[model samples]
Target: MSTAPKTSIIPREVDALKACTQGATYEGVIMPEDLPRLAAAVVSIQREMTGKVRFFRDESNYRMVTAELHTVVSVQCQRCLSALDYQLRAEMDLAIVVSEGQLESLPKEFEGWLLDESGSADLYEAIEEELLLALPIVSYHDQADCSASGQYSTGDFEEPLAEKKNPFAVLGDLKLAGKADSTDKESE
Candidate 1:
């Protein structure tokens, strides 16, 4: 395996096959502004993302890549709708595949990354996808720190109980009327 010199600027495009053959390692900081897709998903980014990506041929002779990323982003709390700083740490182990058919053949331990026709993959896309996956399904600050804590309730908070009609009641009535009309015609 070859060790690549660390660089500050992360390349947007990466030749996965060539990197795998050369056993290249890439590490850098990515500005939040540069990731439009990730920026749009959050309230704001608290800091730049730091990441490392390494490409190499695995023992099974599969072209493989592993990526690790860390970042902090601002996301609205589901409970209070207030901004909360959420730390995201993501790691990925994937086999580089040139076509969709190869995905099904990948080993269970490795997910597949399909390279486009350009023969290179988008470095930012890989990082962004993992980071997005790392985001919490529901974001919230600690109970002690959250302003809207201690207000959770399982019961309804609506006004005093009022009679509610069943949505299917009209259909039931129509059926009853149809039965009554049939009975009347038979009696006639």
Candidate 2:
């Protein structure tokens, strides 16, 4: 696994916005050894990110990280318990603010707006977080994109539109019933 420094605009000014710059394009498979730290942050969401990361940092401390990723995210259909694979396309923009304290904490080589931070910020973590945030909370593979075995279908699942009655309502009714029963007993 190769770790490459982000090639973006240098963070010279501490409190002001600088010119927007783009990072190096990362392409190639990330080995299993490199997956631990990144996987820990992503957990099960790791399946949704696999490809190149093209990042660009702007003058307003806005970092635009784009990835051409391809992965089958595992999702359970709401209608069925069966697991399904959903092809995800994710893109995101992050506003990275570099403080003087954060810059002081980073190594000299890593001294920059995008690199300066509290401790080391993993590139994969940033990429994964951005992608995960862009992803839908619930996703399913469409029938057209499903495997040849007629497995997955977007129609197989349906969201609950009706509001469910609160269980506490039954307790309230029971309390009312008890009150009525006590009144009747007293009358007797």
Q: Write the per-residue lDDT of candidate 2 for residues 12-52, one digit (tens) a residue.
A: 12221222253545554443234454344332433424576
C-alpha-based local distance difference test score of model 2 = 0.50
Best by TM-score: 1
User: In model 2, where do residues sit more than 4 Å from their true spots?
Assistant: 1-23, 31-48, 56-64, 100-120, 140-188
lDDT at position 14, candidate 2: 25
The candidate that achieves the highest lDDT relative to the unseen native structure: 1
Give the alpha carbon lDDT tens digit for every residue of 84-167 in model 1: 998889998888999888888887878888997555989888889888888888888788898888787646676868888998
Taking the candidates one at a time, how many backbone clashes does each contain? 0, 0
Per-prediction TM-score, please? Answer: 0.75, 0.42
